[model samples]
Target: MKLLIVTPHFYPENFKVNDMAFELQKRGHDVSVMTAIPDYPEGRFYKGYGIFKKRRESINGVKVHRSLIIPRHSGSSFWLAMNYLSYTFFASLKSLWFGIAKKYDAIIVHEPSPILVGIPAVIIKKLQKIPVHFWVLDLWPESLTAAGGITNKNIIYPFEKLTKWIYDNCTTLMIGSKGYEKSICNKGDFKDKIEFFPNWVEDSLESQKMIDVPKLPKGFNVVIAGNMGDAQDLPHIMETARMLKGSNIRFNFIGDGRKREYVENYARENGLMNNIFCLGRYPLEAMPAFFAQADILFMALKDTPIFALTVPSRLQAYMSSGKPVVAMINGEGADTIREADCGWSVPAGDSEQLANLLKHLSTLNKDELTQKGANGKEYSRKYYDFTKCINHLEKIIGTGL
Candidate 1:
């Protein structure tokens, strides 16, 4: 099958879409990507890319067509909206041109966020007369408010209408969490279209180099290794660290985000320097070793109604790394951790419960901890392997998942 994946982020941007494209290509499908210029996280063009440079490229034999994208200089809602709108406009225009020139069996729109990408995907679907598989990685409107990106309810109705319009057009709508099902099913006639398609760990996860962490303290390290942004609810995690002060457990935060300084400052001001170590950042390749060294992997999110229906990608990565997790997140993601018997979970923002869970996990012997990690690894392999994920995609391409 000739498949074109439409997304705002793609290869060289460090997203699961890169691996998904690779897996599709590995399966002998002709996979081409249509995405924006790489400007992410730091919100600047990457070293070699500019607004005008390198518009076309190929990765691992797969062709990538990059559309015009404006770098996000600030987190202002207006700029962010322009970023999404301009990317959607240009990507759709370019894709329509590409659609007229080339034919495809299916089109997969990797909707990680900024729901407007569907506008182009829908246009191309109608023009090309092929299946449009909308892979919704995040829920809109709700997510915008939940992530603190946009909070004005008066402005949310348009997004809600747009979200339903996009869903109504797609041949297959795939969601990463079952928690999303109830919300999406409430939309018009979507019951038969929506399917559960969980995210998967990278195929190269085992190849991550074993880097040493010389500064890491020698105790049970509860490692939280991802973006420390607004959604992480880091204040609660810091409070948990403060509560666990004087204990042997060390909280290692190993990522960069908007709230990194806040977390670091809180740790310092409260004399939690020893209890919580704010290690800045690590390359993706270095993550496996960090997880390997951790006695328990830690994850958190703000307690929001929308977040309860979401699962952070790190859950799959933690499980794949064969590490037990202590997840202080909301609903389905927490339920998954418990169901896998991987580790414990506490309600988001509940410092006391998180602290207690940590103490309970600390009481368990190393062998018991290893068993939990092993269970998580086996569970990830059985349920969330990329091979299985793409095979499901194949079935969906043939019919629908």
Candidate 2:
């Protein structure tokens, strides 16, 4: 089977879709993914790549076609919209012209935001008579509004209509959480086509089995890793760090995004320099060792209704690393941790509540923490491993073909 994957984020961008495509290829399917050059979240081009014109290459045996795009930082909504639109246009044109000869059996379009890439997949699927699957990373318009990225009355209606159109047209739509299905199905009026497909943790490929955990800071380490954007409400975490000062616990934020400067500023103002450490963005490959080094893993999100239906990808990674999580988040993400017995969750944005929860963590014995971590690791291996997740995806692709 020939599989064509259309996503704005792919190889060299530290997105999971890269490993996904590789898994598909290893399964004996001919898989090729088309994407823009490796500029994401920051909108800056990677060190060696250029924008404008398509570049073709292969990474670890998977065929890749990189199209030109107007890169913009994730925090800047206007430029980000332009960036997605430009990639949507050029990738569609270039793929149709240069890639049609391969005759794809099925097309998978990853929907991170805006449905830009999915629109192109819809066109190609309609013209070529191939089945198209739209994978929802996050529910769009709603998520955009939740993140305060865009709320203009003039554009909201059109964007919502476009989202409904894409959902209506795709042969199948895969959402990352069960909590998201109802919202998407309601919007698209296509309940039969929507499938619950949570993001999985491919631990062996993405993380190293700890021979031994690395040396921690002077106190117990509570590490939060991944993007520091508005959606995460990192300020609350900073406040929690301040509250933990002089205690036997410290906070380390090991990722970067729009809120990086804000977090740094807050740490400085609160005199948390010794208690909180900000490690800039590290590549996806280097994350596992860092995860192993932590005494507790942290996850949080802004207080928004839409977030109730969302789960951040980092949760899977954190759980798979055999670390107990402290989730100051809402809804599906919180539910997952609760169900797995892997962590504790407090309401979003309440630093006092989060701080108290952190304090409770301090009371847990090493054996209890290890038990929770082990439970999470076991659950991830059995239910949320990429091997299992992608196998389900492959079956869907095969059925479509």
Candidate 3:
């Protein structure tokens, strides 16, 4: 099958769609990606990419088409809107031309947020008369209010309409979290079209050779890997670190994003540097080694309706790393922690509870922690296996529409 994947983020930016495209191509399906220039967590285009330079390239046998987009400078809401809108407009224009020139059996919209990415796929579907399979990893209008902090009805109503139009056009809607079904269905009668398709841990993360990261402080290391964005509830995590000051527990943040500077600043100002360590971002291949040194893997999400329904992609990676997890999250994410019995979870934004949980985890014997980690790994293998997920995705694309 010839498949075209439409996404905002792809290779060189570190997104799950990169793995999906590679796996699809490996499986003999011709896969091409349509994406914007690489400017994600840092909110700037990557060193080697720009509007005119390297716009079209092939990576690992998959053809990639880059579109023009405003970088999300400072990751402010206004800039984020521009970044999303620019890609939607330019990519939709590209889709019209690409749809005619290149024939594909299906188009998959790998939407993590800014659901407008689906607009281009819809355009291609209209032009080529092919199925548009939308894999929704984030909910719109809700994310605007939840993550972007946009509250005005006048601001949200148009996006709500846009979200519905995109959903209505898709031949199939693959939801990342089962909890998303209710919200997506409320937007339209998509009950029949919705399919539960959760994220799998990246292949790189699953089988990486461990190398030492000497920067990690020697203590009860609580590693938080991945994006340190607003949705992560970094304030609560920092507060929890503050509460744990003077203890042997050391908080190691091993990723970067919009709030990374804020977290660094907060640690310095609050004099919590002793308990907290900001290790910045590393490539996906480096995660296992970091996970290897972690006493406990930590994750958190803000207290919001959208977040409560979200099962973060990091959760699967954390579990797959064979690390006992600790999360300050609500709803579906919290439920997964409990269901997997891999770790403990407290209510989102509850620093006191998280601090207490971390303290308790520190007291647990190595054997006990090891068992929890083992449980998580076993569960992840059963449910979040990459091969199984890709097989399911192929089946969905084959039969959808």
lDDT of 3 at 90: 95
Deviation (Å) of 395 in candidate 1 = 1.2
Model 3 spans with C-alpha error above 4 angstroms: 399-401
Local accuracy of candidate 3 as per-residue lDDT tens digits, 1-401: 89999999998988888889998898888899999999987889999999888899999999999999999999987898899899999999999899789899999999888888888899889899989899999899898889888899998999999999988889899988999999999998999999889899887787758766756787899999988889999988888889988899998889888888899899899988888888888888889988988999999999999999988889989999889999999999999999999999999999998999888888889999999999999999999888888989988998322
- Which portions of model 1 miss their true places by more than 4 Å? 74-76, 149-151, 207-209, 212-215, 399-401
| Residue lDDT tens for model 1, 229-311 | 78889989989889988898999988877788888899889988888888877778888777878999989989999889887
Lowest summed-lDDT stretch of 10 residues in model 2?
205-214
Q: What CA RMSD would candidate 1 show?
A: 2.0
Clashes of 3: 0
Backbone clash count for every predicted candidate, in the order shown: 0, 0, 0
Please give the range of 10 consecutive residues that has the lowest summed lDDT in model 1: 205-214
User: What is the lDDT ranking, best to worst?
Assistant: 3, 1, 2
